[model samples]
Target: MVFWITLDPLSDLSRPPGDLSSGDLLNQVLYVALYCLTMAKLIDLGWRGARPLLHPAYLLLLAWFAVSAVLGVNPGTSVRRLVLCAMVMSIVGVLPILPRTQRDLELWLGTAAMIVVVLCYLAVLLVPALSVHQADAPREAGLAGDWRGIYDHKSTAGPMMIVFLFIGAFLAGQGRHLFGGVLFVLSLVFLLFTGTKQPTALMPVILLVSRLALRTRSRLLFLALCLGALALYNLMTVGSAVIPSVSDIVAKLISDPTFTNRTGIWNFAIDRFLERPLTGYGFMGFWSTDAVLQSDPLGQLAWTAEATDSHNSYLDLALTTGFPGLCLALWVVVLMPLLDFMRARLDPTKRGLALLFFRIWLFCIFVAALETVFFLRDSAVWVSFLIAIFGLRYLACYPVRP
Candidate 1:
């Protein structure tokens, strides 16, 4: 459902959002049906052990989203987006239990992710206009000729390929040599053409940390490191804009330390967030709404007003959902997921599955520091992150039955 909705929902890629109106409605119906099935299956399975979805974190976040929606700038837009988010979250609630065992999980993930890869590759080959970014794109015009491959932008496609790349690795470990080799090579080749530097660079970092995590007795240190890395990155990019001193320090290192003008957007976001640090502009309100997007900031960066997001999920959350919501998000997204990975790693048999989810969870959280990824409306990375969190939570508590 995720692959189909993200990749094949639109008939016309040129103007996808409007063209996907009917498709979105259809997908929503499908979501409702699948959600029912997932709930029924959970009931049939005794619902006790399969209680990953019942975590307080998820509930609290949902409640916060609801509250933010009501108090947000555009209540109507917030409500619509919140409904869609609920449907997606509900459907993914049962993904961890869908597979009977670890082997079956590998098979399902391999086949599904490969199908997405093949469709992306075929689009790039047959309809370059649709699959690849053109020189004339409205945003990120410099990204022309990069491969987006049935996605709205190369940024989205790059992370999806990385997810597939790991599925390929898992398949290889499971003795599906031919499938694994082809999937890995193809995913790697496609990822390179996307020209997304962060994902490409972070892959190795995630792998290295995962290796350390498995061998070490403490996952807490690694968690601290993760937080540290994000902190340093924020300090470099947005922090520079917030403090003149930080910008002075970063300027000594890089010629354009603003990370291609991301700090300008961050600065504007920070200014607004300070105005209403408690309640925020509301869900889907800060950046996407017409009032905010069209409004002119006379002394601020003009481009920042027209920007899509704060370019930092942490800051974006604070801007839209307030500081408390952001803190709740940190608990839900960052801490518990890693702790789940740590617990799941105790069993040697569950090692591979645990690591897979660990890697996926790790990548998303790190990526979140740079990108606006938390609840970004069915984004591929956001969907995969939820899947990883659920997978780890389930694995930590229950065994994969043969």
Candidate 2:
């Protein structure tokens, strides 16, 4: 988590190095070594926590990814991205088994989260230019004064602090009340200053919904709540583009109905998606590509051709891997995580840990509505969500006591 977070700070992002992948030799080597160590540990544990890796949904998702790699518009890029993603998945797969008990799990994760929090604060205090966005910065100058806090963007920092809030809550509920409370307060204070309104607004509500989800114990109800949030958010943002009435309503409701010019991007992406709906351009292949940017030129109002992603994860998946890939992703990453959480919660002793992961999963999944996060190439947000995914799976598959 720390590696991903600190790997690409906002300062480095302002002046990105050429050939991002080739220059990332250190990351490649570290991932390989960690992958080997985890595999060895899995073997020592008699391959514990390996069942979910072989699930039919996960297998089909892999198969579809292979299909995308072979048939994608850019086969070379797809293959490289596929390999990197597999390495991350392998590490995520074995992580849950390392902790023998719930307390051990909390300690390891809490310590890492606290480290992240401390480093973020230090960046803010000692290197304000890097930690806080500048008004005169070449890019997104309008976002001046926002606290990114060691992250690439304020949006990224805000959601991550929200995840840490849940982690703190988990620790407190588990008997480390003083430490956990401190973590919670620190994260909350940091989040308030992130200058990203969406996550800040979702903070208290997420806490309430998560507690209610645990109390209700209805998987269907949980899905209803998540899908409802997605629809409301989409309706206000991109849905306005699909319906004239929605556009008019949104225009009346907000100062900028275009949602910072996202509607044009969404429309352009939709048109492209319609062209090759079955199989997308390729995994992470649609945007920022020479062929794509040069061909099917977007209109003036459209998002910059240099845009890294479509700003919507589900759309990015469909744009890259096709509609089939998106469906598989929904089943594999979305639905399956929900199922794991539901089953895991039934184990009374593991409920607290399970709830913590579930809460994180919900937030990431919801936030992805407006962000390209699901498989965005080793992003800290993606890593955090995967940890929640596998963590819940482990709790459901194995009964552990604190």
* Number of the top TM-score candidate: 2
Q: Candidate 1: TM-score? A: 0.91
Quickly count the clashes in candidate 1. 0
For model 1, residues 135-177, the per-residue Cα lDDT tens digits are 6555556877888887877778898899888878878877899
- lDDT per residue, candidate 2, 129-240, as tens digits? 8888886666668888778888978888998899898999999988999999999999999998888876787777778887887887566787787667766876767677
Give all TM-scores, in the order shown. Answer: 0.91, 0.93
Off by over 4 Å in 1: 1-27, 44-46, 293-305
Q: State, as a TM-score between 0 and 1, how close model 2 is to the true structure.
A: 0.93
CA-lDDT, candidates in order: 0.78, 0.80
Candidate 2 at residue 61, lDDT? 91
Count of clashing residue pairs in every prediction: 0, 2
